[model samples]
Target: MKALSHLNKYLLKYKWYLIWGTTFTVISNLFGIIPAQLVRYSLDLVKETLDIYFLYNGSRLQSNLYDVFAFSILFYGLLILAMALLKGFFLFLVRQTLIVMSRHIEYDLKNEIYLHYQTLPLSFFRQHNTGDLMARISEDVSKVRMYVGPSIMYGLNLITLFVLVISYMVSINARLSLYVLLPLPVLSVAIYVVNTIIIKRSEEIQRSLSRLSTFVQEAFSGIRVLKAFVREENSATNFTVESDVYKQKSLQLTRVDSLFFPLIMLLVGFSNVLVVYVGGQEILTGRLTPGNIMEFILYVNMLTWPVMALGWTTSQTQRAAASQQRINEFLAVKTDLVSEKSLEREIAGEVEFRNVRFVYPDSGIVALKNFNLNVKAGETVAILGTTGSGKSSLANLLTRMYDPTDGVILIDGIPLKEYSLTSIRRQMGYVPQEVFLFSETISNNVKFGMPEMPQEKVEQAVKDADLYQNIIEFPEKFDTRIGERGVTLSGGQKQRLSIARAIARDPKILILDDCLSAVDTNTENIILNNLHRIMENRTSVVISHRVSSAKLADKILVLDEGEVVEHGTHEELLAANGVYRELYEKQLQAEEV
Candidate 1:
């Protein structure tokens, strides 16, 4: 009952639909039951007129038995035709309403879930794979719809059938009706046991299925990499392993599923047998009429559905409960990054980091420590470091992707937390070391696939990135579609396009994390020179591996092992005999060799 009570909450929005649907079902079934009753009643009326034929000592029929039989046949045919028409109309009506309700509920819930994902921190995505989350939105949500719309309608029909059958049975013989209901308790117990197993197994099956899908997606996306590495056998083996787990789990679920209805039928079979046997004896003893016995059998036949439906509903109820619990668990994890609770406002380009220390949510130690820096309203600061020295992590802090564990970041001398995330984010443009591009047209990629953007603005951004000339050489130019992750583009092209997309917004503070790494030094110089022209009077952070790249910056900071070891002008840092001097001298020596 509590499970049903929980399910009703989702159904509350569709109360009017259920009310009209159930009413139609009841009316249709009333006409349906009439024909069965006519057969028994017509036979009883014939007993009044037939010849002496009771070898078992039954009463003879009265006069005009053939006319009575003919009238009953006509009424039965008319009742069936009327029932068919009513049932068909009800089918059309309920289907239309349920389809609308299902679509509305699906859309509303999907939007809410998507918005929830937006509010969660980046750590959430790191902990869960992209494919599994996609499956939940697509496949799992569809299952929820199944539970909501049609499941409810069929459930109502089953209940209506049960109620009508019981009322008619009471009219036949009260004591015998009680006897026919004897196995109902057993039916309940069986359903409870089977439902528990199905629920537990279904959850396992769903988890395994998600994992299998994730593995396939990962493999497909990295197929070129796997082929280049000659890891096809390994990839296939890994997929096979995942697929096997899903297969076994699904079979275990099916094993449980196949037993649900038949086993319930087996338990309820005795009642069906007992009704005919006991009701027939009552008739022979002159305690019940033939029509009464026939009516009782119809009622017995009707109990089968609710019993079977109870079993199926039991499984569906548990699935919905499990799904809700999983969704609740996801929503319960508090986000580490918190935005401003107040109004959003514009931000000035000035940024300051005071003794900032950052620790990744997954790591035990700080990735950036004791960092102190300031960028004026319009300045270019370049960061120099070896791999794993927290270059990209520094840029991430500016956007508040992860807040510092110990220190404060300020915008226009106000604590960054004071400004809403949208306001703060709108002022900064970032191009990561690992460039990510969507599958879309070249123009859409430049626009980051924004549904609406000025065409001239996109063209300007592409020109600024120095990719406009190359794009025009492609077969379709601006209309040329990019593949997933920009697979169709070269590494340098991808990085340039990502840079173009970020720059398209005309941001106040721009950060490039070795985004020019893929291009040749000559090409890199051209793009950087172009960026300088466009980013005039704008605050910028640039990270580059080549020592020559730092020469264009107003100031340079050298980092090693997450600590800022040296900071000053490019000339001053080389004279300081610190991390910057060492890195510069090493690159110089490599070029000489």
Candidate 2:
């Protein structure tokens, strides 16, 4: 119940819908109960007229009274039909207002969750799986909608009908009404007990559902791997286990849910029996008539559906509460990447790391320690390092994907945090070790960073990356659609496409993080020759292990175990006979062989 309180704002937002729906519900119930009274009047009129007919049997007056009696019964029947039609119309209005409001709220809620997801840090994503996140937005939201829409509408209907029907019953015969309602207290106790059990079971069922969704999502996403490894049977067995767990949990809930209507009907049945037995005693004492008994029966029948609906409404509300609790947990998480300043400024690409140290939050691995570097604007610096030497960490910090734990990073003499994230990212083009491209046309992927880029610039970027020939060979050229994550392209082609995307942005600062590892030496040389011209005025940081890639840089750095072991120009580093020289000599021998 407390978790459901989060929706109070949405309720207030659509208060007019709720107000009108409530009005309609009340009117519908009012019209509904009137038919029972009409039944009572028709029954009493028939009883009285029959008695009069008996008294005037075979007399001249009997025939005249017969027509009047027929007309009276026909009039009451018409009134009952009108009441039913009016009740139905109001019910339609109730669904239009309330149900439509729920849909509007659902739209707003999903958008809010998705927008919040975009703001969360990468570490948050690392901690959660894709399937669970998707379940929260899709499945959990649907359950909450049930609470806001059908559960609320039916719950209100139940209360309204009960009030009208019970009040009328008491007014006619208090003693008989008391006996008929005696079983209701027992029904109340049953509802309370069942509601408690349902909430617990509902939570279990939701958790099982999430696990099942995750299993199916992972299985499909890795189907290629599974087939390559010949693990189809094993995967199917695992799926069966997850499915069985979900099935058992659902059945448990259904078993409990199945008790609801029967218990309600049983209590209702007792109420009906009490109405008949007690009403008969009242008639024997001349305090009640046959019309009263018949009307009481009609009223009890009128209350039956609402009472039966109570179980369903309660179950849905409990499920909704469980789902809302899950949603609230994520909504309450605060991202640590808040910007202290949001001013947009032009980045001159003079990047500096002053005593920077960082540790990966999830793995607790120290990726950088006392790392310091300064690159002047319009300079090219190549960082050479072996695996696990913290080469990629610099790129992550420069992009502000993760902040350093210890020191400050500055761009153009301004602290990195001083500029807005959007401004900083917009001016910098980064090609990471792991390249990702959308399942879109070649031109669209190239122009992703700048959607409005011209076709000439797109061609130039493709040429600069040395991928122009391959793209032109395709039937659609730049318009060719690459499959998911560029799966249709070869590894080198994918890496080159990523480079073309970065180049298309025309960024002031360009960082290529080992993007040429897959291309042949000839292709790499061509790209480097083109980059020599592109890097003339722009700040560029080329991170790689190959000595050939660093030969053109103004300065070269050799990193060992998260620390800089050597730094100098290529000629100076070769003359120094240190780690950089050793790496160069080894790579040169391998190329010669």
Candidate 3:
């Protein structure tokens, strides 16, 4: 019960539906019980009225009795038909209200989880896998829905039937009712024992499924790498191992269900045998009529379903509880980053980091130590560094992808914490080292950052990124669909597309973290030349390994091992005979070759 506490609020949202659904289920069960009584009465009528019709033909008693018998059968048949029709109608309403509500809850829950995913910091994604998250959103939510829909309604139906049937049986003959109900306590104990195992196994099954989903997602995402390395057979063997584990867990759950459900049926069968044996003697001694015994048997037969339902409801409830626990665990995660205040004034792109230090959460190794720099409006500052020198870390802090472990970062002299994340980030355009593009049209991908931009502005951004001519070469031009991660486009084209997307926003600050690395040096020069005019009034941060690219910046800062080694214009750094000079000379020699 504690496992399902998280779903209470969502269930309350549809309380009216729940009320009506319960009403419909109760009515349906009540109607379903009526046919058994009608069967008993119709049989008794035949026994009482048969002799009169044959012995006294055309007499008043005969005529009246015959008419009564005929009418009873007709009424009995009509009642059965009417009950069936009414039960079907109400059952439809039960499904509409309850089953549909479950689907609605599923929709709400999935959306909530998706929104939570968006709000989580990068560290959370680092800790969780894409496939596991996908499984929770899809499969786990579906399992919870089973409890919300069928388990709830069916459990209610079973209760209604038990109350109505048991009360009627007790009224007919309390002795027989007591004898027939003897096995139920035993069945209850069995259900409890089996359901405990079911719950544990269900949790294991869900976890195994999550692992399987994660494996498939990873395998497909890295399919190219695997094929290039000729690891197809190895991947298959790994997949088979995971698949077998899921199968074994599933089979274990099925085995438990197999044992428990049949045990319930056997208990029901035993109760029927008891009623027949005890009531047969009562009929012989004239204490109970044949019709009375038959009615009791009919009532017990109706009780069988509730008995069977007891086992099913228990199993499904346990499974749902397990799934709910997993979902709640995920939803309970608190993000490390949040906005404490919102700045109403727009950012001017005067970025400064004062005595900043950053250490990754997972590694606990400092990526940047005592990092300090300031870029005024209308200036371009290029960050040049070796791998792991925290070039990208600076861009991350500026965009609020991460916060420094110590000290402050400010945009226009205001602390980053004072501004809302979106407010500060909205002013900045950042292109990461690795670019990702959705499966969408060329134009759609370009306008992803600014969907409502004028066509002329979009075209200008494409031209400025130097990707316009290549896009025009496609048969449908901007309308052409790029495959997943822009697999349909060349490496250089993908990077250019990312640049165009960033430029489409016309942000006050632009940070390109090795975005144009895939393009040729000539294309890189062309793109940088185009950005020169655009960077004239806005601050720009370029993180690059190439000295040729950084040479265009107003100031070039060289970083080594997470600390700044030198800072100056390209010519001044060259004359200083430092790290920048060493990199420039090597690059110049490489290009000359």
Candidate 4:
């Protein structure tokens, strides 16, 4: 019912179309009743053994004598043709208008869902499958569109059939018509009971279908990894299981669907047999006439659709319910942190951490505790740490990806929470440990941060990142498509592309999270030298395990076991003969050996 209600809101917007649609439905029924009445009158005329006086539709045309058989055939034929013309004319317009409205609903819903997904915080994506999210936006929204179109049309058609049939039945012989409708309650109950099962099964089928779609999407996206690992058989087997599950669920639901038509036929068939047996005796005993029997039979035909539509409407209702549930689930999700706070002034890059403590949700392991640091604007800082040393978490706090649990991270002496998320991130040009480029042209990827960039700006940024020469070397130059995740490009080139993309924005502060590890030492040095020129009077934070990169910064912080164990200039850290010295000596020894 909830699914039906949501669909109704949109359908009601075009009420006049449905109004005319239902009115035309009744018009079809009116024409449909004419053939049975004509047959009975023609039979009565023949039985009386009198010359059949035909008005020829009141035109007084001679259609009589030896041509009576031909006249009867032509009369019914032309009536059927006229009925068909009326039915098709109205049904066509109704179908066209409904489809247009359904398309509008589909377009609006798909765009809105996609936009909502974009605005949702990062954690929402982290806990959900990418393919599942896609299914909710694509497949489920389409289900709603299908429901909105045909289900409403059919459901209303059923009501019109009921009203038209009952009116005709009561007008002919109220007492006899009442007896014919005796089987209706039984038929209704049967439809109701069977429809419940159909609805339940339909939901199961839809869910299994989404799971299969997700599996296929994931398989395609990660095909390269599977092939590289020689896991083709494993992937195929997994996909087959998902597909088979989908098939079984669809078959099960359709099995229920198959039962519906047969049940309606049986019940309606039983009613027909009863009406004919009883109505025949009534006519023979002078209690009724052949005309009444013929009319009842026509009414029975009218009843067929309502029974058939019960099955279709049941299926559509169930799909809509499932789609609504999925959409509701997405709308309910809320992110733990991040906001858009408006401030009167712009933020300078000076960053401070005061008594910062952090822990991940599932893994309650403390990644940082009582972390404190203060760096002034225009000063370059480097962080050296082993794996899982909370260096990345610290950077995440500065970018406001995750907030500290027990303390404050500040920018320019203002709490991070006080600054708008956009304002905070706009100041920092961050390059993650793993570089990713879109499956788009190199120029488009480089200019991604500032898409409306001038050609000169894009070219200059590429040059500053030391990637312009490499891009021009390609046959298609910067317009060449980078394969998925920049797979077609070398690791060094990918990192430089990431650098170019980040540099294109011309941010006030830049954070490089060991993002240039793939480049040679000489190349890394040159990139760093260029970065220094760009970062002049601008803050920059370098994070790397490589000592060569650390030497470029004016100050360094060495972290161990979620704690900052050392902080100083390169010479000061070497003089302390602690963690930084040990790390420096290890690199030197590795080169010498």
Which candidate comes out best when scored by TM-score? Answer: 3
Which parts of model 4 are misplaced by more than 4 Å?
Answer: 3-80, 285-292, 336-340, 591-593
lDDT of 2 by residue, 1-593 (tens): 89999999999999999999999999999999898888888888988899999999999899999999999999999999999999999999999999999999899889989999988877888888888899999999999999999998999999988898889999999999999889888888888898899999888888888888888888887777999999999999998999998899889889989998999888888888998999999999999998899999988888888888888998899999999999999999878776788869887789899999999898899988899999999999999999999999999899988889999999999989888998889999999898899989999999996889999999999999999999999999999999887888999999999999997898999999999999988899999999999998899999998989996799988998899999999999999999999999999999888
lDDT of 1 by residue, 92-187 (tens): 776766656767777766776688888887768877987777767766667666667666666776777778777777776787888898888877
Where is the poorest 10-residue window by lDDT in model 3? 336-345
Q: How much lDDT does each candidate structure score?
A: 0.77, 0.91, 0.88, 0.78
What is the per-residue lDDT of model 4 for residues 1-593, given as tens digits with 9 covering 90 to 100?
76446556556776676677667666766666666666666555555433444434344444344366667657766876787677678667667665666787778778877887877765567667777788888888887877766776777678777887788778877767777788778767876787688767767776787787778888788788888999999989998888888888888877777877787788778768867987898888887677678768867876887767877776777777778777767866766665546553565678888999988654577889788888889888998899889888777777777778889887888888877776667667888887888999988997786779888888887887788888888999878999998989998999988988887788777888888789987788788889888877778888888888887788899988788899999999999999899999998898677
Report the Cα lDDT for residue 437, model 4: 88
Best by lDDT: 2
- Model 3, range 234-318, lDDT digits (tens) per residue? 9999999999999999999999999876897888889889889998988787776677777888777787877788798889889
Clashing residue pairs in candidate 3 are none
> Would you list the clashing residue pairs of candidate 4?
none
Question: What is the lDDT for 59 in model 4?
Answer: 47
State TM-scores per candidate. 0.92, 0.95, 0.97, 0.89
Better of 1 and 2 by TM-score: 2
By lDDT, the better pick of 1 and 2 is 2
- Which candidate, 2 or 4, would have the higher lDDT against the true structure? 2
Which parts of model 2 have CA positions greater than 4 angstroms off?
Answer: none
The local distance difference test score of model 1 is 0.77
